[model samples]
Target: MFDQDKDTGGLQGKVILITGGTSGLGAQCVLRLALNNASHIYFTGRNTKKGSAIIKETHDAGCTTPLTFVECDLTKLASVKAAADKILSEQHRLDLLMANAGVMNQPPGLTADGYEVQFGTNFLSHALLIQKFLPLMDKTAELPGSDVRIVQLTSTGFRGAPSGGIRFDDLKTVQNFRVLGGMMRYGQSKLAAVLYAQELARRHPNIISVSVTPGIVSTELVSKQNAFHRSTIWLSAKITQGRIYSPKEAPASQLWCAVGPRNEIKQGAFYEPVGILSKITTKYTQDEDLAWRLWDWTQSELKQWLD
Candidate 1:
């Protein structure tokens, strides 16, 4: 699995940004792209030691392109912008983006930006990142090999959200707050991820925007949460025989979604299980107008961070 492909230069010459690079699924993306001969690899995370260590390890393992680390807490819009600006200052080209970092505990906290933990980190941050970084989306509208992409990482667990749809009246879910409140709230946040992807796909027409599930990955991210999340996962993993994927395996879908063949995959497609194009939730597929509104609302909410 670690060997380089001689025939398909799948990610060659691409400048890619992945959000949660310190551990888990995102780190796996860092490894896969490094070996695939990508021209530049930049990822964002809050851990200075681990982030720098991953960069060193990538170099030791032999990467042809420059490997970089940008520290940004996905929970904060200001931080995301700082990271994007850092990328712009450092390089002129950006070929792919994996909006993959998030926190999942059922506990409710607010980001520095003052949104709920679930919504702020997972939803608004990714939305803001894309809007601010739109300039680097590569201006090709019709040309083949013009690879520009935004891949959103959502979850099957999103289906478990009580809302089962975008809860427009309670985007933050602060009034009905409980542990279950967080369950639905987290799911609601991921809906924003998927809906955001859908919105970008429709509006841009050319950029390859899609959402994907990483299949359950066994990573340190799971352990970072409070007792509530860890207990639920522990119970779930036991019932499923604890087969959550290793971070390395989890990146299979995300990496493919970013660089996989466009003709084979659909635009605005959701993917999982090693490049298999997955389905959008039925409600989302039908609610094109809702996605558009959600996109606009997010822009309005983050207007100050847009610059």
Candidate 2:
């Protein structure tokens, strides 16, 4: 275990950003980082009400650190860009960027931009956010003793992805071909996260980029699943009898990645809970060629926004 208690105080004066900070693991991350005394914390979510509640909750907890909520709906690229631009215009340095918001096992659909829903919301939006912030992150890394990190949250569910990792041929479609359509699409999106982190580390050596799994937490992401999918989740839970962490307990690895000593975490690696560098048996996840290809594809897709 990664102990949050021991990790306190290091984040003083650090600037941090998290996605989906209104609830679940994202909310917990906000609380933890605020408690750790981060100088300024910016988190993104669609719910202004919940965002306000989080700020209040943090203040009530006696964490006087400033928390700003950037209204963002990841389904729309334009909204993502607006949020990024706002943050970039305001913040001089970004020490940590946590790509933590995501949907899991969602029904077949497309984003506002016409890509598969999970792919767009989970992977592409975070990609855009990271891309938009790289310059500031680079500047931060140049400062003496600055430790800039980008943490992308992925899942072991990537095992369920299509054999090829990502179905590039039909990313613009719903990807409803197979029996486990939702999971397959979810896995595909998450696999993209892992590959993207790897590519990011290669391209930006100054930043520490890694993907991580929270190890099956119970959150709104689970409760929002449709009836059939919910039952499948229930069945799996019963079979494994696995320990499902609460939001607070689940973000240990992410927090550790965000603030843990720079020498301890490998650049561009995948970690399980509490900073364990997991061995990725899936061959596709280890494919450098596929990682680069996905990077090229993402850049092409987001060319307009990038310009």
Candidate 3:
């Protein structure tokens, strides 16, 4: 377990951003960072009511740190760009970014950009957010005592991706395979997240980029699932004898990655809960060529939004 008392103070004076900050693991992250005295906290969520609630909750808890909520709908690329632009215009330096918002095994659909819903919401939009903020993060790294990091939340489900990993030819359509279609799409997006972190560390050595799996957390992501899906999850947990963590307990790994000592973290590595470096057994996740390919494709696709 993460020692909140010991680790929470590490973020003092740091500027931070978190996606999907309205609830679940993301909301926990926001509260923890705010209470720890981060210089400023800028978070994004689609619901204005929930956004305001987070801000109010921080204030009610006597957290003096400035918390700003930018309304963002991750399913839309235009909204993602606008959120980035709004933050970039306000803050000169951003020390940490937590790409914590995502969707799970939902029905087949497309995002506003015409890409598969899961892949677009989970990976592509976060990619655009990272791209927009890279220059600022790079500059932040140059400052004295600066430590810049990007934390991408991935999952063990990445191992369940289709045979060839990402199906690039069919990204524009819903990858509705007959069986396990939703999981397959979810896995592909998460795989992209892991690969993106690796390529990011390689390209920007100054900034620390890493992916982490929070394990099975008892959040709306699971609780709101249909009865069948929820039962399947519980059965799997029982078989594995795994622990289902609450939202408060689940943010430990990502929080540690965000504020832990720089020397202790490996660049471009994937981690399990509370700072354990996990080995990538799947050959697809270990492919350097595929990582580069995804990076190039993402860049080409988001070129219009970058400027």
Q: Pick the candidate with the highest lDDT.
A: 3
Each candidate structure's count of clashing pairs: 0, 0, 0
Predicted candidate 2 versus true structure: per-residue lDDT over 131-249, tens digit per residue: 89998999999999899999999988898898689989899999886688889999999999999999999999999999999877789888888888777776776564365677778
**Model 2, stretches more than 4 Å misplaced?**
234-241
TM per candidate: 0.88, 0.96, 0.97
Candidate 1 global lDDT? 0.75
Considering every candidate listed, which one attains the maximal TM-score?
A: 3
Q: Each model's C-alpha lDDT?
A: 0.75, 0.90, 0.92
Comparing 1 with 2 on TM-score, the higher-scoring candidate is 2
lDDT of 3 by residue, 1-307 (tens): 5675467776677899999999998998999889988889999999999999999998999999999999999999999999999999999999999999999997999999999999999999999999999999999999999999999999988988998899999999998899989989999999999999999999999999999998878788899888988888777666643757778888988988998878999999999888989975589889999999999999999999997
Residue-level error in angstroms, candidate 3, position 60: 1.2
